[model samples]
Target: MPDPHSSDAEPRPAHSAPSSLLSRIKALLRPAPPADREGIRAVLEAAHDHSILDGESYAMISGALEVADKTVADIMVSRSRMDLLDVSLSLTEQMRTIIETGHSRFPVYEGDRDNIIGVLLAKDLLLTLSDHALDIRALIRPPVFIPESKRLNELLHQFRISRNHLAIVIDEHGGICGLVTMEDVLEQIVGDIEDEFDDEDEKTIFRTGDNSWRAMGTTEIEDFNDVFHVQLPDEDYDTLNGWLAAELGHIPRRGEHFQSQGLTFTVVGADGKRARWLHVQRVSGASSSPETHTP
Candidate 1:
């Protein structure tokens, strides 16, 4: 009989495999357990509870998962709020608008916002000032247009491949509805990303008295609740302004006051449509309610 372990033994057929190979084949024969969203969420929550992941990390993971179901329409800057430049305006005038907005880029339009021709990068305009003869149009980059319904994940991928920072969101009728930026998409994943323009010492909610506080319209509902030690419903809205809007059935204008959840929200500063700053005060001896609101 030949020694099976000996190299000198007759060579086995090509199809015959070693014992270690057979073990790997056995391992491959077993299928992995199927995983669903709920299972993944549970795992994440467990990790969070064990402190394997921080709260911010958990929130960002959840946001990343949530973004897959969101579209450009959800977080886009509405047309009314967009800072635009008219191509018909003189370079000096356009520079003034750019400086006032403190924006690095602006959509250039021929006649109106609807007639957007291209994007004008602020840095590109500097070169024009140095060389007065340079055509402003030559510096304009072709605008990227995306459908309002396009999923954010797909948009992010397009942004990566195209190297574009902003895209004009178009409605079904082929009209510009709003604009979305790379920052907007990333904000969803990593929470708010403040720029240099943001006030470093600005407080979202400032205590003015024993029970009175001045809060920014953009202050997150959770932060507001933590600061006031109140249980405010946050399921329907994220910001104080959004909650006020939902309560009032419309965006509250300046000088408007809405009472809800044992708190009185007074719009102290606002533009035509959205509230900018609000004065909040707790109603003495009043019980909190989830749905009760008075205008």
Candidate 2:
């Protein structure tokens, strides 16, 4: 009989490229039995030999496996970052405001952000604008309520089937919490998303100019270190807000001024007790300054 250990034992095509991914996958599947430490090593080695999988495919499989474990809280835009329509206004006012904000989809609320009634499409507003006062009640679409722990992939499918872009994410107590958009869901599949509504100029944290810097309050203390290249060591804070709070020892009111590490923080606009907005600038070299006053 012909030698069984000869070339006949290798049944694979001789012309196959050494880098052929299918050939490597076949190699990976060829292992037998207990698959102990050594066998596991072979699986990894075989995987390395093949380009059978790509980054996108790996992300998809990983996402599917971990999706249920992922929460809407993980993917939902924070309330501070949300662009929602305060539906307490008249329809005309709402439409005008939405136009100014440049957001096509908006969450509509009756009295407060916590009482979201439904979502309104910009197209619907245009249709109703012919009348003096567009009827917001009539233009409202049914709100899709999602828990903060809902899986993103499931929500994406829901968005497709229902043709809804905005979903109101609710907390366990049924309070209106955050908002998630179809774009937010898509960003999960891809990476960070840049859309028309997002201002390119506002993308960076601290933007410097002639004697002014517009910074997002959420910019990290470490980033503050990097941008100004300074070491302001306040042990208790990681955000400008935290720094301001620590300096003030209380929630700062509008027009309050505090100084630390050669920088001055002025509370520009505040909602009640919390500092909703701030103006930050390097303290000009001068004599001692008076307490800040608001206009």
Candidate 3:
């Protein structure tokens, strides 16, 4: 009020260049903080553009932010795709499934798949090896049920506190819709993390016999072409499974087949939304020998 242009009238706070990324971000948002996700995104994009945050860190942080907005239903394995165990099955039969599926844990149901009673750990079955008198039900751990609408951030908190890796998702009417796992949540932040069961380098694509080969659905389109020496035209799609789904016009089911780009892709194994494994056969008369695509 005394002098509008005088520096002495109102001593302004010296805005020194922020030392750390956190300080820089705080400095950028100053008096008005981000209002919503989009506002936060704007601030993050600004930081990203200014080289305040590196590519990897920005991607992970952005993924974590995305997790907060998503619900369990977004990434959950659908109820139909869940590999559940039948409580009525004999121990021998259960062991077969455990061996085949390569899953560490399975949800055990009584009469119906919807009637999930508890979870069974594959390691727990080893207890029956030494002690033949142990009851099967005794090994079953209580199952956790979560609402599908529950935010992934809250679910992640619950997973951390309860140490429960898996939780059954239910609808508003208490109907089983799907299941979510800690791996699923973690993948959202850090991208895909491979386990022991995941396809290894050479194991990604295996030569079955003759002109047929077995390939994991996650196989990269480029890898597939490199192995078979054929151009599959990966313009929009990245993975073979993704491209197959688009060609089929829907999520491929086991036994369904699609022919494209001089190849026959048969869904050998599949879940609700994606193919797990595929049988690929060279339909065109390519000069490449079958031995070339081995492994």
Candidate 4:
């Protein structure tokens, strides 16, 4: 055996990694089940704090618990932003909108946006090109209308049973309010769900509209500042998502917006635990001057 003080000896780890996480959890809850949700969450949190549970596992578990309390209105895409396909439009017009949105599916409307007729899959359009006699209406699948007040847990159950991926949301007066997707519900439990719109490369931000941009939450604050020519404080946070959470006093959620230094920060993509993407736009006549924030 080598001498205990030998400099050439490989240093042993101060301690071995903790035992299997399941065993740790079982030990923590050996006597009985937690009396309530709060009690169960407290135990989970304690384990998380002690490093027995990793951050991703902790976040997902917490998110699953939270979904039961959230409503459709909490995360649905608002009416004004929905990409509705107008049935009256010519094939060219419909194709233009669909390509621009880059969505796999859209809600079909008859006359008004509120009068949603059905759902249309982008892939369904390929047949239209080949069959000149096909009616556009024939391509639509029945639209599912859900009330904005509907609970997310119930909605998720319905989605699974029906195998429908999208639903139109309506207000109490039966007017269109927004839309929801299966991906949206799943996101609450599994973090960001990558889609056709998401770029996995070094391109962290993309121009969405005139003077508006979409950026990943993980984009470096420095990169964002350089792209937009504005100074957002990078002293405290490495990513824009971190700063937004601190600014909002919690993990940023979808559809939440805040105005700061003449720019609007709207969280467009987020799960239950963190912002995945954000839409940032410069307010009209707003100057991109050097700015400072106290928090």
Highest lDDT scorer: 4
Q: By TM-score, rank the candidates, best first.
A: 3, 4, 1, 2
Which tens-of-lDDT digit does each residue in 3-37 have in candidate 3?
87887786655654444666878888886889899
Q: In every candidate, how many clashes are there? A: 0, 0, 0, 0
lDDT at 214, model 2:
48
Q: Write the per-residue lDDT of candidate 4 for residues 1-43, one digit (tens) a residue.
A: 8898999988876544444666788898887779988988998
- In terms of TM-score, the best-performing candidate is 3
Whole-model lDDT, candidate 3?
0.79
Query: Would you estimate the TM-scores of all the predictions?
Result: 0.59, 0.50, 0.66, 0.63
- Model 2, residue 45: C-alpha shift (Å): 11
The lDDT of each candidate is 0.79, 0.64, 0.79, 0.82
Off by over 4 Å in 3: 1-31, 127-135, 205-215, 220-243, 251-295
Clashing pairs in 1: none
Tens digits of lDDT, candidate 1, 21-66: 9989889997544387777788889889999999999999988887
Model 2 Cα displacement at 113 (Å)?
2.4
Q: Flag regions of model 2 displaced more than 4 Å.
A: 1-50, 54-68, 128-132, 197-295
1-295 in candidate 2: lDDT tens per residue?
8787798775767867866978888988985653564554455445545856565665554445455456788867556555567766777666544643345677777777777787888877666667856567777788888898888778888889998888888888988777888876665556445444335354434333455454444556777778766675547787766766665777766556676556666664343335544556676773243434332
Name every residue pair that clashes in candidate 4.
none
Report the CA-based lDDT of candidate 2 relative to the real structure.
0.64
